[model samples]
Target chain A: MRVFENWDTSLKIPSMFLLMMSMALIRDQYLISLLPCVAAILFIASGLPLSLLLSRFRAPIVFLLFVSVFLVLFSEGDALVRIGPVVLKSQGAILALNTCVRVLSVITVGIVMIYTTPLSGLSGKLKRMLIPHILVDIGIMTGRYIMVIGEDYNKMKTARKLRGYMPGKSMARRFGVIVPTAATLLIKGFQQSERVFNAMRMRGYGSSAAGEARSYALERPSISSFLMFLATVTVSVLLIVLEVTVETA
Target chain B: MHIPDGMLPGEICAAGYAGTAALTWLCIKKARSSTEDPARIVSRASVMAAAFFVVSWVHIPLPPVSVHPVLAGLMGILLGWISFPAILVGLFFQAAMFGHGGFTTLGVNALSMGGAALLAWAVYRLLNRKSGERAILISGFVAGFAGVSLAVIFTGSVLILTIPAHIDAGTEISAILAMAAAHLPLALAEGVFTALVARFLLRVKPDMLL
Candidate 1:
């Protein structure tokens, strides 16, 4: 876990993306089945808490379960089992299993990437990767402010509660309160942004020469980082090759 | 709704990415040409995105259940061409921080949600030519309702059409219709909320409505 944490974001981001894309490309049921095991091994190796992963996994897992149930019940195929006027088809079961495994594996990789990499570092890496400069800047600012605005929201909610405000059973009444609160927040945010922009302008932001000077200064990867990146690419390529071969055969 | 990874085939995902890239490029170009100060636009959009993210946590209670508003319509009316990039940023954070959405399906999710936002913005602008608070409220309601409805339809169609299942065409169409029908109530609720907020903003901070 420490090793992954210490890895450069430039290398780590692309490697994880490649790993996820490869996992997505694998379609064979057997190959797809192996992915969850691989993901488990990766999870154990990362040393992240099981509870944390499970909590992150909860929503997607519930969704997958719903999808799997629908597939098993509604999909057309030979019956594998009969239960109280319901038929479980073998093909549906296989499809469900494949879908569940594939989604879990991809999600696990994403989880690992997010947990291991710092968001600040990730944004910097994205800027270096030739993404639109304004977009990346906006992303960074948005990331910084989500927590701040969220805290403001909490305070406002608490204040409302203190003032004897409670969302009643009536939906119309609830909207009347909630919409005003949301609008107030938006106004606050807009005012704050105007101040922020003024401050940034005072600091010489949006200077064309300065912007050009800062864009896309690519850094060469360390030997270890390069080797890891190479290994990841090789694995991803191999996975695609194998899948293509199987499909063609 | 955000589609999780591995739900659709890789080809569809790839195509989604391609389409998103093109749209993002076009939006950025539009934003750059339209605004005088790039930094100000970025800052404003970022703040608005954060506010939208926080506001989405506000629960709307419907008997036996509740839902968070997507706010894509409000976003479009407020941010204009920048709404797509703002949404993309918000979705990215949602996936990274909470694992609420999918890494692989980010492009598709953005297209469904952000594309709906753009449509809503166009509708609002078109209907808002008449000057008055009533006009603003009516436009806001229509945009909000249209935004959620289009997003639901787009997401449902994509899921039903691309899902690797053996269901017949009739069943597939039925599933898509059912999904859209189930979301109608939520769309109506969003419309009312948007209209109310638009009216409030018009009274307090009239400039913010744009």
Candidate 2:
């Protein structure tokens, strides 16, 4: 949870947004390589367990490989490998590889953002924006209960395990149990929502308890944060322009 | 179909985000103006989103291939107009937690899934009048099939528009069609599954079906 907690949430998000945008736009594979290296440096600076940080990406890297294959199999290029009559293109392969790097880098930026900042910090900033109160409230709850749902899922999985259910059953029976269980979880979750809503309503959730007009103007973020965001944007734009210029030249 | 990161061109993916945002905003506006309590809707949407996150994570077996159920029909019927936000929230968490999809690709994923849920809701609404096993089964089939079928077409269309054709156009088109075709079995399975769940809900809490 505390992987990159040192950085200011308000500062980190905008910069990361710029970084992701830059990564998405930059076509130069070599320039794209620098993003992940930067992410690694940030992670190393955070002093969280290197193993845990790396483990977060293991599944995704595997998945990226699978998806990148699609790009490799279908894009234009010279043939790299052939199976019987089927040929894989070299151009396609490089395109897929470059894409894999960008995807990974973008995800890395996202992970850095969410991990460094507390969810409340992000949501609190959101509330200060013109976003609807109900939307923010729902987002906060969703962020909180993803773990709750995950725990419930694990418990169900354990219970199924304890029952000595054999694996490799008919597809119908497998999803038969799963579909109903998901429905049950949903029904239970719905009931919980009703209780929570009732409790909030009892406390006058939507009414002008604090009087919405009394709220002062939102505080500006720190100068350092603003500068950081500006710098990120400037650098990202340069990266994009440099890559495009190089491509066109 | 969960289109993972880097599968589509960045431009198409960007469009996906914009499309999802506009649709989600519309759904939110509509939901807010509805007679239902906003607080109640938030709570329901949150919990439903939780359900969606869980269902998406659990891999279901389909004999030849294992696939995650889109559950668009179920989400559409259960959450109605709120399905867009609910799906968005669900997808957001999934991306954050499992890296199931990427941050940039989120918009397209949401559009494909949430768009289909909305479509499914409309299909279900059209069939809600007749009350019987026959009507329920047909409704369920249509909802489930339309949900996945439309999602495939959307996913395929996005990739088609973004990816350059050239020599790969034939292969890419085939790939898109194959992806859509692969989901056909799952869509049929979803139909049967939806029918069963809908019938169960009908007996227990018929109001939910409505």
Candidate 3:
């Protein structure tokens, strides 16, 4: 229920910024990946469960691996190994390796930012940072209703099952029910919005936020926090410069 | 149409984000100038965003992954000018919650997915002259197909521009081709589903189609 209350929530974004910049700058291998690797471990030690982390990353990671394989197989350069006519380019293999490490690193940074800090905190941060009011509202609404409408979907599926409607028969067959289900959910959403709008009106939502909106009273980053952020950014910038110079030389 | 993180260079990704931000601002301004109240659009947009996020989770297995109906045509038909922001919010949640896409690549994904919704809406508006069921069906099908296909093209453009920097030109070309070809089935499926949803919307909630 508490929003913008994460411990040092302000610093996460800077760290993520650094992580991402370093991720893009690194060309070759695991040296740059070590930062995020250690960060991920520290995140887990700080309390995010291993399963939660895996579940968060499983699909994208699988897709990353799948695409990297294609890159390794199809790319052209000096052949490192050959099995019959299919040649694995050493360059492609390296590219794939770099791709994999970059993905893992970025994904870790994203997980740390998103999981360690609740979205409410992020929203509050965005608000403080002067994001447009409507966009911020939309972001907050998305977090709220993803859970709400997701529950509605589960209930609808269950009700359909109880009515003896068999589930999807094939990849193609599911569209029959899914379309109507989506339609139903959308219509329900519209109807639900009316009540919500009315409730907000009754609660004096519009009038007060505008009149009293300027000061949100959020926890600003401390002086030490600012120094830490500066250090992180400097390190990342230095790493990127070092890698680029090395690559060119 | 989600571009996973690190698939494109940072500059390309930055460009995607920049373009999407501009589009978002334009959409918001357009929505404001339109007849319907902006607050009402926000409420509708928010709910639709939630719907988009939910359906994305209910994926039907295709091969290495599952493909879900984007329902972009439906969003375009219903939300009018609000579809882009709605889809953007949905993609944001998708990235944050499920890691279906990455945060840094979000602009690329949003422009692909949400831009498709905006395109679908435009197509529906252009084609639905008669307001009849048959017109709705045709418009919906075309909107859906074009939405998905255009999204693939946008994705391909990003990949084409970025992947060659990391891998060989041949591999990049083939990867783009393979991705475009892979989405054909999904596009066709989306076409059918969009028509169905549009038909249902027309029959049951006629006012919503406006």
Best by TM-score: 1
Candidate that would win on lDDT: 1
TM-score of 3: 0.89
Backbone clashes for every candidate come to: 0, 0, 0
DockQ of each: 0.77, 0.54, 0.56
lDDT of 3 at B94: 72
Worst 10 residues of 1 chain B by lDDT: B5-14
Q: Could you list the chain B TM-scores for each candidate? A: 0.96, 0.89, 0.88
User: What global local distance difference test value does model 1 have?
Assistant: 0.84
Tens digit per residue, CA lDDT, model 2, B10-91:
5666787788778878998888788457777788888778766776666667777777778888889888988888887777
i-RMSD of all predictions? 1.2, 2.7, 2.6
Candidate 1 vs 2: which has more lDDT: 1
> How would you encode candidate 3's per-residue C-alpha lDDT over A215-248 as one tens digit per residue?
5544567676566567667766777777778778
Q: Rank the candidates by DockQ, best first.
A: 1, 3, 2
lDDT of 1 by residue, A53-122 (tens): 8888887888788778878887998999999898998888898889888998889878887788766555
Give one digit per residue, the lDDT tens place, for model 1 in B1-210: 788877777777788888888898888888878877887778888999999999999987666788899888989988888899899989988887777778888889899999999999999999999878889989999999988999999988998888778899998888889888989988988887888888888899989876
For candidate 1, report its TM-score: 0.95
